[model samples]
Target: MVSAWVVTKVAYVVISIAAGLIFFYVTSPLVKSEKKQPLEESVSLLINFVLYIWVGKILLNIDVFITDPLAILAYPSDSDAFYAATLLLFGNVIYKVKWKGLNIGTIMSSLAPVFLGSAFVYEFIEVVMNDSTLAWGHLGLLFLLLLFFLIFHERQSSVATAGGIFTAWSLGQLILTFYLPYTTLYGYMMTRWFLVLVFILSMTNLIQNKRLRS
Candidate 1:
């Protein structure tokens, strides 16, 4: 049987994702016209992303899964699973862009709001439900990013805006890690070096987008 804690966590995830979808639709008008994806497409992508994460979890715990597939539901996923999911997601995106002729920029633009919105909701839940004070810092950071995106989204290119938000978020999380007792996102054990790498990648993407526009 699935544990109550697992059920609660899944409920939180569902709530967060719903919040993200609502946020995306509410803010759709502000997104760059050229980068806006259809609602169906965005939903499909999000579903696929969630599936990838589940697959990652299963793969990371293959031993347990092989022994008793039903038992897997009780196991919690960790940073390693997250990394695996991310890599798989990245590969899937690349494949879509290259062979399926999907617009990478549009995908990124469509995903940005949902990602931030979900993150904000998740952190808020952590603070309220779990009494995690550290989550407040992450909540504050996401709130500012969302506000900034709303304020300047109409004026900025979607890729640039997404890149900027990610860069800022990564840097903010990195700084928070120094003073906080644990990692921000899902309380996963993300190392400072990983955050730095994300920061660098986001900054690079932002710069490249600017140069392309110029």
Candidate 2:
């Protein structure tokens, strides 16, 4: 007999997988122009991320992981593992693109729509499951707008589209941080960092478009 906790964890993982698949399916056309399946790349990246996290977790608690390899899957690990995995994921992407000459912009553009779509689905599911109304207004609207632009603005450069979406998202986060209830310190800081990223992306997009025009 499966325990309730195990069932819940399994359900969450299933939901995450389903959400990712749906996101990939919906954004298939964006990558079709390049004869690519962005979701496949996303899944590969995700696998690397999870592998990093799992390894970090195991290394952090080697004795427990070694003793009960199967049992470790049922519980959440340390936040340090999550943070470390996230940093390493970025590093891995940068290493691949910068050193290996991977098409970074194309990958990012392919990923942009799927990112927002998956996020919207996951957040909506969380809201429904938790019966919470915190993120429905601003963040949800931003995701919807991002999806709309990515779907309709096929003529624009992918970098521009991605930058526009990130700008809108940063603006939304800023508003949510200031004007909304249920705000936390971590959320506030994270929003600021997102805004910084938005600025960088916007500048890069501007330069890219300018070069294309010249």
| Top lDDT prediction, candidate number | 1
lDDT of each: 0.81, 0.62
Q: What is the TM-score of each candidate against the true structure?
A: 0.91, 0.69
Worst 10 residues of 1 by lDDT: 30-39
How do the residues 1-214 of candidate 1 rate in per-residue lDDT, one tens digit apiece?
3478777877887899889878888887654553245555668777776777779989988898998987775766678777777778778888989998987777777778888988899889999989987788889999999999898777888778889898998999899888887675754667788789889988998888888899
Clashing pairs in 2: none
Candidate 2 stretches greater than 4 Å from native: 1-10, 13-17, 30-37, 55-81, 181-191, 194-214
**Model 2 — which ten-residue stretch has the worst lDDT?**
182-191
Give the candidate number with the greatest TM-score.
1
How would you encode candidate 2's per-residue C-alpha lDDT over 1-214 as one tens digit per residue?
3456546644655565567557656654544555354666767776787688777777777788789976665556456666567677878888878997766666666656655665565556656676546747644665677657656657777666766666666566656766666322111124455455655765676577658767
